[model samples]
Target chain A: MRTTHVGSYPKIPDLPAPGRWRTAAEKLQRGEITREEFRRVEDEVTREAIADQVGAGLDMVTDGQIRWEDPQTYFARRMDGFSIDGLQRWFDTNVYYRQPVAQGRVAWREPVTVEDYRFARSHSPRPVRPVVTGPYTLARLSQNRYYPRFSDFVLDVAQALNRELRALDAESPPLIQVDEPAILQHKEDLALFREAAAALLEGVRAPVALYTYFGDARGVVRVFYELPVEVVGLDFVAGVRNWEVLESEGFPQDRRLGFGVVDARNTRLETVDEVLRALDRVSRFVPLDRVDLGPTAGLEFLPRRAAKAKLVRIAEVKRAALEVTR
Target chain B: MNGLPLFPTTTVGSFPKPPYLLEARRKRLRGQIEPEQLRQLEEQATREWIQRQEELGLDVFVDGEMYRGDMVAYFADEMEGFAIAGLVRSYGNRYYPKPVVVGPVGRRRPITVEWFRFAQSLTGKPVKGMLTGPYTIAEWSFNEYYPTRRELVLELARAIHEEAVDLERAGARFIQIDEPAIHTRPDEDFDLAREAMEIVTDGLSAYTITHVCYGDVPRIYPRMLDLPVHQIDLALKNEDFALLEVFRQHRFTKDIGLGVIDAHSHRVETAEEVLDGIRRSLEVFEPRQVYVSPDCGLKTRTIDETVGKLAAMVEGARRAREELGAG
Candidate 1:
């Protein structure tokens, strides 16, 4: 449950670079702007945020989730068989482009888009995580709209994304991170999550780090240990005891383990020493090369300034801690 | 005695305590004032809140949660097997380190009656017996103990259920279980949440209600159709009124506590806007199943804003009733 040495955090010091538009998202519900207009603003704002993170100096950098509407939303847009009609009111905490439960057979109406993602990759020479909402998470979260079974819809969406990821693989850097935040919602879904995960990820050749946030991984920490995935991410903030489960459940030592000790949703910054203490504890489970670092969840919920400031500290402290301690 | 109509219009449950009462309660908890004195102060605040709503001609009123602690923390303490960790600095000096849920909860004593009685005693209005729903209590706590999140919630639900029966036995007629956490449910787990909810609220005798906001109604839809609660108090003011058509399609039969006022906003909503909201609600929901209320709670709002908005909501409901010839 504790890190013995320096571990990974979304130590990335940048945000998404400035750019332009494509799909619809939950932002449309907020009436902040039209979907097309939002795409452009977000693309650019994302660059600014990433620049800010890079300016701060940290380890790995992502487009700060610049390409998609939400983790699951952009993926939904790529495929067409599902209708946006059945989604319950947008999400309760964070909004997403949700599809309602149908016959569970998920089909894509449109070809998944990726130009803006390549645009994000173009932002810097730094190692960036090409983020994709995991196919299992996407299918699991969306309503099939017409499908009869959850797995059927989930697997279909997963297979399509595998194709997308494989294409993404042909074009860009090989690292693709799949966010499966919903996996923590229940225990029963852990095995099913692994199964569905294995499917969507079947053809992709990149190193995959499956991520879950906001709650405990108590149910499926074991499935994660055995899954064919290259890495696994666990939330350590609100999910106060997920680490204990991981320790008890036993994850593979060779696979990369993403330790999320930073509080992404809250504004208060933890002292460098405090974070180092957490990192040190996580290191106990895996060596530095086998661990990645990041917040417990997305940096979206925190006010932009707070999130930026937090990343600043994360980047700085990580450099000092890793250099001296490791 | 049954005190109110099913799924009545009321606050989600916190009221800003008058400075003096808050000071006194702090003093009382610190062993300064006697329980009787604290009781008097709560009753006084409850009287004022009730009178304010009565003056607005509200059909049902709450004592504005004059007696409970902060909504999430109160229930967090009663949860079973949680090690009350020493305070973790949350935001500021207002230190509230939650108890880690390490095991199952078995309620040993009553938690919210003294204030419910004091409020009901002072008013002729029907008072709401409010409690935080299970899903919320689990979500708000450090969920470290349970084998799974669902089991953790079911334990909390059973505990809340015991409280509901106690309130009903103690002359309470209506109950509202606030569940803003439903908004946080993963898009895929709506039915899992509903399943847990049904188990927790299985046998409550009074009209049970759930208040949640800001999610696609469909995430909870059709699935919510099966919950044990008789009514759903939801937020609608921030979104366009047309967003409500989904509920109509589902033929949701439960009473709907239509939030005519946006709780997150402080600007006093005009009567016309309020009426438009009520009208929009009526377009989709039958009048009998509709009860006018704020989208969420008033804790984040000022006293004046709360009063002003409630007044606006009541006036709008009256207009709708008259226009429909149901008055």
Candidate 2:
């Protein structure tokens, strides 16, 4: 029952300033470098990033999503139709990533690599919140070049993820976080989101978490509360105005609040006082344990050094949270 | 001529670039398609459009944005601190790039100079040099890096003015700088915009036109008229006419491009109604000083509707011409 960022950090190679993660992955896959060598590199990157979060005094830690790409199919080996394609534009900016798409039906390209899910669990020592791209967001992002309705496709995606989450739950992961960033953009389609949320966590045995970032809930958090989710996440940065809407419209008491106060898009590091103030105000409505202090979105939008700095700040806020709790 | 009636019309930009032609432009960019073949495709559309305009006897001939790839997308290649990652699928799966303003922007060289020169060459009638204004570019960008949005706009203004002077050198008598995003910011930026306008039209010749529409004109109109542009094309089709009094108050020295045609709706405005809109303009502008053109670029519109609307606009002007002579 906690919060985290969308999982997957591009593992940096030991060599001074590697070209891209793919080139490093290729060297390993081609047998030019041993798997142990690749693991060491990823291990260094993740351990340093996780320690930064822990040092920042963050209550929860994500492996900085260092080794995941798109994350929808990182671990699921069996699915109806899905695979990685040639590099395409992610939001049509200067940066490019190899895009994942649904080839036929919504299914997994591979099994959930339980390594990061397990590694994060082991790495945090403190409670680690497992973050995955939500089924609905994945369905909406991937083209319907094959799948018909995104709702139907997301249902299949959610179903496949259930197996992964259940396996993580059996391994005793504390929380599973679903990254539904696309919901803010598709505010008008609330029913589809509710249905999609219900579908993804359908059989997940773990305490389920869902995070929405980058925009306002359109004051539509009311519709979201109706989902069978235990904790609902929102980006307080953009959704500041929507809080009033949440106050006016009632929320389900069964759900916890994952309040996103840190801004992931910008490089500015937040202080302990600012994080404490947000935690205090958000805690007034939800119980102290029900709220997690974290950034509004993923650190992927920032450069590696800045991203690490922000996570360090997250840990600081978590310490502030403990002080408030005591 | 000063006492004679004035006419103005407009169309939204981004005329339908068929996939074949779009691919051809991409090919040209990649060095696959020859400049001649690309010219042939654009020229094919341009020549036909001008012929239709002349046949209809429209006063100014717009080349219908035949050569430019996308209104905002074209800037991605020219500017720094930004990169075209991928397209934004909005308004029903129409993809446009999310122009991430990852840093500050600067110009590389002239973007629209060659095509505008080519367009001007095809028609004997006066040609309209089309440019997307800096404010629009700034508004459309993510602009997260800038300390203030105004700085980014001013930076864009410098870049826009660079191309505008080039277009003027390329034989552009009428440069229509599009500023549909001007009003989106707060009211305080208007003065800054006025200063930027002076910079954009700084070395330009006569007949600098600023195309603006779909916002409160009373606040924007007077501030805009104070700029260096010779004519202001205002959206009158879906706006209040009371603001025309602001121009009447200034004894407006610059001409007005009164958008008598409704570009938003598909229903073609009747020639009589468009003429009626012109009669209303007579109250503000002296006849010769008034010009007729679309409210904006015809880019999003279908080719047939553009021609039909332009033909209707001309027919309305013919009516205005006949009525003014009689009056």
- Chain A accuracy of model 1 expressed as TM-score: 0.82
The DockQ-based CAPRI class assigned to model 1 is: incorrect
lDDT of all predictions, in order shown?
0.66, 0.67
- Give the runs in model 1 whose Cα sits over 4 Å from its true position: A1-289, A292-326, B1-9, B22-39, B78-80, B83-97, B186-189
Query: Each predicted model: what fraction of the native A–B Cα contacts (within 8 Å) does it retain?
Result: 0.12, 0.02
The CA lDDT at A209 in model 1 is 73
Q: Which portions of model 2 miss their true places by more than 4 Å?
A: A1-326, B1-5, B8-14, B18-36, B216-221, B239-254, B283-289
lDDT of 1 at A286: 75
How well is each residue in A220-267 modelled by candidate 1, as lDDT tens digits? 787777777787888888677877886787668768877778776554
The DockQ leader among the candidates is: 1
lDDT of 2 by residue, B19-102 (tens): 567788878968998999998988887766667667776656577777766666677567777765333322211335446566
